[model samples]
Target: MNKTFQYVSYLWDEQKAKSLGDDQVALLIYRSNILGADLRITNYGGGNTSCKTIEKDPLTGKDVEVMWVKGSGGDIGTLTKSGLAALYVDKLRALEGIYRGIAHEDEMVGLFNHCIYDLDSKAPSIDTPLHSFLPFKHIDHLHPDAAIAIAASKDGEKITAELFEGQIAWVPWQRPGFDLGLQLRNALDANPGIRGIMLGGHGLFTWGDTAYECYINSLEVIEKASAFLATNYGKKRPIFGGEKIKSLVGSQRKEQAARIAPLLRGLASSYSRMVGTFNDSDTVLQFINSHDLSKLAPMGTSCPDHFLRTKIAPLVLDIPASQDLSDLGAVKSHIEKLFADYRDGYKKYYETHKRHNSPALRDPNPVVILWPGVGMFSYAKDKQTSRVASEFYINAINVMRGAEAVSEYVSLPLQEAFDIEYWLLEEAKLQRMPKEKALSRKVALITGSAGGIGKAIADKLAEEGACVVLTDIDEDRLANARKDFGKDAAIAVKLDVLDNDTIGQAYKAACLAFGGVDIIVNCAGLAISKPLAETTEADWDLLNDVLVKGQFKVSQAGVSILRTQGLGGDIVNIVSKNALVSGPNNVGYGTAKAAQIHMSRLLAAELGPDKIRVNVVNPDAVIEGSKIWEGKWAEGRAKAYGVTVEELPAFYAKRTLLNEIISTKDIANGVLAFVGGLLGKSTGNILNVDGGVAAAFVR
Candidate 1:
């Protein structure tokens, strides 16, 4: 172990402990956070921890020993006391005897559930027995990549001994269950002096009398594995392809990804519905573009923990280094065959490992797909999961590289991987998650999304679980808007609605970012409220270009991508009440908006055969959070109404039957009602979001 890698202790601070109230629980959370904060120790939800403590039993008014293990679905890094489920120690320990005859995995889960001390507490982690069975006050189990690299090696046992000098016990890979728990318990009993246990093909387990001790032990073991890998394997820089490969793949990798991602996404959709995000960074590109990727990638995941996120193996698309990626038809045909082959391979893997009670076959779509010319694409139902799978697979590449540098990289046996994949406990963790949001797995693209009604719509769509693409002419504001939504929920693109090329590029970016968009919100517009006689040809052209032509171009681009994906989609245009009821002197703005409404109807009629729906929202006076009604436009409108600027908002509100001012959020809600399928089977409809503007209501 590297003795010099200092471990910072957060539990020793009295003030911090005082705030949490329970010193022991505070210490446990502190240490768990420490483990989670470091990707080298654990990534996301890859590990579990536990602490044995004495707490007063509210019913009996007596102190009782309880095992507070990490609750199901809890990530150690951000875990709190509430995230830990407490089980009565004596009752949980008694299960060891009862579990002897219980071979069925489902029965074991029932038993674990029955042992929960608090009725309201979360289900305990499956490894609860592994911790309870061990005679330790504090325990930490993690799937650290370094430890996994050593554990998944051909001579893992020998390497473990050399690195830890018999300080840790080695248990052969066992499917995590009652039997595996027993094996772990018996192994520790025989090696009573060991500080930790390394499960072959799995991960590391360490325990101590205190949180700091257990944490440090985990750190020491990981440091030892890292040091061993560094000393034995030595670092090998990935081979960036030669000029030939680079020239063939194209000098612009990002542009190549944009072009190729849609084909891959479309192909993947044939097997199952999923969204894909592209990765073409230096590290990912270096790994994917390597000559030896074909030999290295199929070996398997770095550890069994990855089986749930990333499938057992990635699907490698064989794009010839000499081929051009610009040919969409060729790329599409190749991807179709690759997806079919990958699905067939997965089915065969399942058939070979099928058991009488094995879980149902999972979606056969590949989570990780490696394209030679265009880096990697990770697919999931949502952007977050796709990104997570990408991270895991990228790390897998590094782990495999390190292991191969020293020795052959060996993953768990196929059956073991299958066991983890089908384990009832892991399945339960997924089942325990909250119901999917209304727009879960859906992708939305909003135009003019930098601020106001457009941004509101973007926020609402994302809140409903849709990955959004926000576009605007204001690049800085668009970037800031994307940042506000975070990378997981939104991506930004600078777009001029009037430019056909930019509109097409934005559609491609959406496809590259999230498979393909399911919803298109056209909110970009220009307002010029002038008398018909005063309106100039240039004024009419500008409004027509931005409000009518721009929207038409965006819709055209969006529908093309949607058609290629073969998935039904929705288009909601943010028009104005002026379209329904013409206001005096607003010739250009009203005429263009009226054209948009008519265009949407035409589009709906044409696209209904493809299951595409087109709808329009007519908002009257959205003064607050409305960029359209600001500065000169607001002043002109107020003057036209013969009212002060401050009174203009009130005047418009009082004109409505509801006598209420409309907000951007109100308009967004109306759009959501249509696009989110609340008005199912209804298309070519106009939703009036003008706070009860009766004249604007669709007749």
Candidate 2:
């Protein structure tokens, strides 16, 4: 149960599972997590595992068997006890008596709820019957690329028979439901001593007497398939029948990817707004550059799990690496034409395969797109989904490679694929998905993001479901601030808005990280307080550079990307109340703030034609967490007001019309009001987050 092989790692620690003692469900979770850890075993959320145990029935006060399987939409790698669905084993068996036949198998799914052993258990998955009907105490069902490579080959059934030599049986593709579960039970009955089944055009199923045995059985089968594929793969010359168009160099590869990412993201979001993930690993490049890419790509993925993540097939752009990318006009035109054709093709596919009971046609856009030399692009509702979709396609590529090396690769027949895609059950699961966040699929970039107000805005946007780019001149704080956000939610860049190169580089990073930016919060600034008599040339230049010039360059950069996406966007500038109020000892800082205010109005007027909204938030006397208040500005302001620095918060509050102290979060909320689709219609306007000093009120 705990032996290692040259192919797959044996991750099960005997002490770990044994430590659980009598907790059989905990043991299953331990086994499932280890198996799901390896991509060679299964892609994210692609596999499920189960165990059966005897527990006293609350009503009968007698010991009864209960089957615990992974719950609907749960990921094995991250599964918890709450994520497993528990049903009475005997109740599951009783359903067979009422089951009409294969035609009525779907109705059995509804019947599964009646078999619940515990009222609080998670909702059952469709594969419940397969695990319940099986005689084994422990079972693992997985869609490992290595095994699917063998299962999806043209001679898969023949090869499975020859390789395992009666140790394993083959089950032709069948939709996972009560009917397939019955078939699995029948297979076990016929094979007598067989350990597992190679599910044709799908995946593998392995069973054992216990959790440890089941874990080992799953690994052993996958390892053998992997070793066989590796050996056959090396013997075969020039994988995928040699390379066609060469892969672009690393620099050119990323350059091209970043350049086309926005356009492609916009095109892919035709059906609905979607986030995108790009991958250019060596594995991806090899497949993308292969000679048989054109021939094999259109054949699509074989595994149902892969098909669900990726669409019927990826849209392959035949642009060679040698093609000129300097002028994007021609490239854009060609891309548009291909997109039109792809939509038409997808509609026809739906028309040809749809049945009377089929669910309505969903998004016709391709989930994946193959750009040779540029890498793979996958789109979905959010970053994680897009990233997971990309991983699934890479698994599909591995499946295609192994199948072609050993035997001709074959995808699931289109009819079978349509049946699963349009299945009412699948549609129901889709309907059950949680509603997306207001800012979901939108990406935001905030300058001085490591600073107080900037960080607040960054966190707020990310919380509202937008991917965020945190840019700051403070390298240490920038790095540390990003730690608070999830990997899929944020990226940090050390950007100095004074430098045009850094300004452009930040946008490039933002595009590469999250496809492109939809919200730009210009919050980078430093304050200076100097009387006319004491103000120096250097003071004037510094305030102008960081405040007025900095915001201008950053806003200019963000607008370029937003325009390219052709999607209306929001630009929120964090200015100061000093711009509207005339105060002693604030000549330089106030002038810079005035410039920022007018500039926002200018840009808002110009960019309105492009459907881009530019607004401003003016904050005043914010002492806590303000980088400006940490230096000479606070000392000067305190000296000017004849009050101690410690009393600044109270002093600012007392002067306000409402006598309220504004925090960094308050400023963040002001920015959100503009970009969060609340006050989205109003632009070239200002929202004051200050305590409402009468002198600063706009007339």
Candidate 3:
């Protein structure tokens, strides 16, 4: 089939680009292709690119304009005014002498901090200092398809030398950021007038006096090398017609548009308020249906730059025409097998070629897949991500076609792709944060949270900046409680502890609503004041269900989500003071609380491997705004003490060393304390928030 290339211009509007301020222009570039699309093509933010904008900085005694680079975690497409972090050029260049001696990540992080405002943003992209060392006015580093096609081949050096004819210099792919940047600096120093640099199993870096020039050089360099490969390997026999493939992909595209339009709209609606506004119809369904998918898949990426969009691979499913395979377990299983085999092959390749830490095997999903009749699978993190992935695929197809025309295009090893995909330090950086302050992005679930102790713990956690999901069976009390805290203070859920399934569903809903859960405080418990003979089976069951079973179920669900994020979490259970110092009348409630204490310890021991910490907070005499302060709970106590209802609280408070009522806020603070750094390293340890009542009795 004679395929006609479609020109889909992604370049920004010239007027828009012109009107942008220096910071805005840099952001636009970072937001568009350079950062968003560029980082995705390799591994987790693998390839680095920076623009040398003239900016004023006070150094020595005079003010000078130096380059400020994109800080780490600064998603290019999502790049904002705060994303471009500053680094002094002289300081960056000076590191060239000692970059090799840095042994730990902290040293590199320190070096980056010396040149940047660490508090303002994430660690500057490891390439920040490297970009600072470069002499170019405008710079771009990418994993281009054409370059790697030649570089990853058996005769990579020979092929690149013949293709570029000594125009582009090549470097072996080293660990990126500091190490790789140092190597490149040395290479550039040795070879004075090099236009571009190609890292084996990595990508390409090019710079110029202007954006257009730099972009043009990138296009021209790849275009020439791709032309050379195509001249040699161009297909002579017309194995497939372009029209036939297009027709098949066209119909599938229509179906895909229908399936994804609503879904993309929903996702956009959910996230638009935060950042990265929604994609238009054209972008949302850009590559849903592609005509010549077979031809494109073999082409791989126009360069390695497509990884940011397509990922390392896509999840390929062979759907049978007779059955709806999307929901079929058998179909899903088959797809899983294909992904596993592909990953296994990648592992073997990695072991054979690379000598270093073994990369984590990512999900064996293909970044781009060829479906026989439906067309191609273009996968990405989101809508814009998909769009970027498709562009890389299109470019890769063009480069591969051109390279094939010149010669057989050699692909990179699967292991090399794995190295780029599962870079450990890169993965570590994505999850790195202060453990105590990590709850900022997390949602916390606290049960038995209405009035008294439960409400207190909920309030403290909310004040500490956690989005609290508070639940209790008291519908009226819970509603009034939420109102008291204000509408947006916390989410109030009516939870019946007796219903195990409902507790599980609540956990799931919290995750779906607010990303994932970081903490679970099981405080929804009740006390049954009765003699052992008077305590019925139903009363015993009720106590066990709320105090012991409910906490267990919710914590189970919370752990699963936490593990996916790769951050260990914490859980606090609200046990009663009676559990430690019990009376004959409180047998049922005390026994349930006893079981809860042991359960918390067991969970702590079991979950310690995953870094999930669990502990208990025992509260005494919490009767504010409750029947316990007026009715049956205070009835017998008042009579025995020969005191009034208000005096009962005072009597209990006086028995303690501090002589202060343990308010809901007191217990809540204890929960928050455990949530933070105040608890030291102890887990499974019981915290007494009872005004020293238990300590006095022990002494």
Top lDDT model? 2
Which ranking of candidates, highest TM-score first? 2, 1, 3
Candidate 1, superposed: residue stretches over 4 Å from native: 1-22, 234-251, 321-325, 500-505
On TM-score, the leading prediction is: 2
RMSD in Å for all candidates: 3.2, 1.5, 12.1
Q: Please, what are the lDDT tens digits per residue for candidate 1 over residues 1-699?
A: 233563222224446646766567678888888788877777787789988888888889899888888887878988987888888888777876766454564577667777777776767767777777887899998988777777777878887887788898899877666666777789888888999999887789998898767877888878778777767543443332222245234446566666666666766766456778787666576667766677667767857668678998999877754456556676676678888888999999888997887778888888898776567889887888888788788767767755665566787678878877877667777777898888878899999999999999999998998899999999988877877786688888888998877787787788778877889999987688788788899999999999999989899988877777777789999999999886787888889999999999999999998889999999887887677777877877887788988998899989988899898999989989997767868799998988787777786
TM-score of 3: 0.47
lDDT string for model 3 (239-331, tens) is 222233222344344343223222222222221210011121231222323333344444344234444345544433344322353333445
Candidate 2 residues 1-699, lDDT tens each?
Answer: 449687777898878877899799999999888988888898899878999999999999999999999998899988889999999999998998998998887788899999999888888988999899888899999998888999999999988888888888999888899988889989989899999998898899999998888988998898888888988985767789887777888878887887788888888887787888888999998998888898998888889889888988999987776567666676888998888898999899999999998998889898999898779989898899999999999999999999999999999889888888888888988899888898998999999999799999998999999999999999999999999999799989989989988887788777677778889999998887878999999999999999989998899878877877788799999999999999889999999999999999999999998899999999987677878898788889988999988888899899899899999989988888898777878999999989787887777
lDDT of each: 0.80, 0.88, 0.58
**With candidate 1 superimposed using the best TM-score fit, by how many Å does residue 215's alpha carbon deviate from the native?**
2.0
| Residue 331 miss distance in model 2 (angstroms) | 1.7
Error of 1 at 201 (Å): 0.5
